[model samples]
Target: MKRMLSLVVTTAALLLALPASAQFAKPEDAIKYRKSALTVMGTHWARLAGMAQGRIPYDAKAAADNAAVLEVAHKLPWAAFGADTQSGDTKAKSEIWKEPAKFKEAEERLFAEVPKIVAAARSGKQDDLKAAFAAGGGVCKNCHDNFRQ
Candidate 1:
């Protein structure tokens, strides 16, 4: 866990050093980056959701592991949503650019909620996990409904 956390910290620091506008060489590259990050986030999110909803048996260690990955994964795609990347192979709606404030609100909400999930998972309590999952999922779904196609 320590090694994984260290690597995540290092990667995040490196990413942060780059300007968002210069992160991608082309619009399609941004789209691909966004899609790849979202896919990774979605995969871990599904595992946590399954456990919370009882589709998959709840194991504290598994929840912790998934949530740890999610902590990093969830922050990835947002930086790729620059203006240059808006017209690519993406399902992102025009509303995202049209209503930047609203889109940003949704992103902030999700960012705020992810730590709660990490905390709940670390708690080793299924009920806590369920509550956090519901709150976090609501933020995620709201973004999909408003910004995504």
Candidate 2:
């Protein structure tokens, strides 16, 4: 029993050490990963939007932190939307696969806008940050309107 336990622990450790791309053995795992990343991104984006909309008081540091998180988080979910992941507990629309070019364009728009938000937030200008935040949110909304249910 002890030898079996040791082998199991060794196997788990080896799996944990693998690269993230190599870690998903199933499409469901990838879907779950993407969903989790999007959830985190949404949480951070909401915080930034609250400040941008004046629903919450602006703190330069907090805005900067949230923008930084969005910069990273925005890049995470795409890889998980693999071909095998089409049928899942996701709000992702079928058009993402059917209309790949359009989807890619939307993704490109988001990638382009997120950095501007980060730069504006880091600049400590609330007005600029607010504008950037709206632009970024619009990018997200555009993608959601087209791709998400």
In model 2, the runs with Cα more than 4 Å from the true position are: 1-23
lDDT of 1 by residue, 1-149 (tens): 99999999999999898877687888899889999999999999889889889999999999999999999999999988888877868999999889999999999998998899888888999999999887776878889998988
Summarize candidate 2's per-residue lDDT along 38-80 as a digit string, tens digits. Answer: 9998898888888888898999999989988988998988877
Summed backbone clashes in each candidate are 0, 0
Model 1 C-alpha RMSD vs. true structure (Å) is: 4.9
Mark the regions of model 1 whose C-alpha exceeds 4 Å error after superposition.
1-17
Q: Against the hidden reference, what TM-scores do the models get?
A: 0.87, 0.82
Tell me model 1's lDDT, rounded to 2 decimals: 0.90
Q: Pick the candidate with the highest lDDT.
A: 1
What RMSD value applies to candidate 2? 6.3
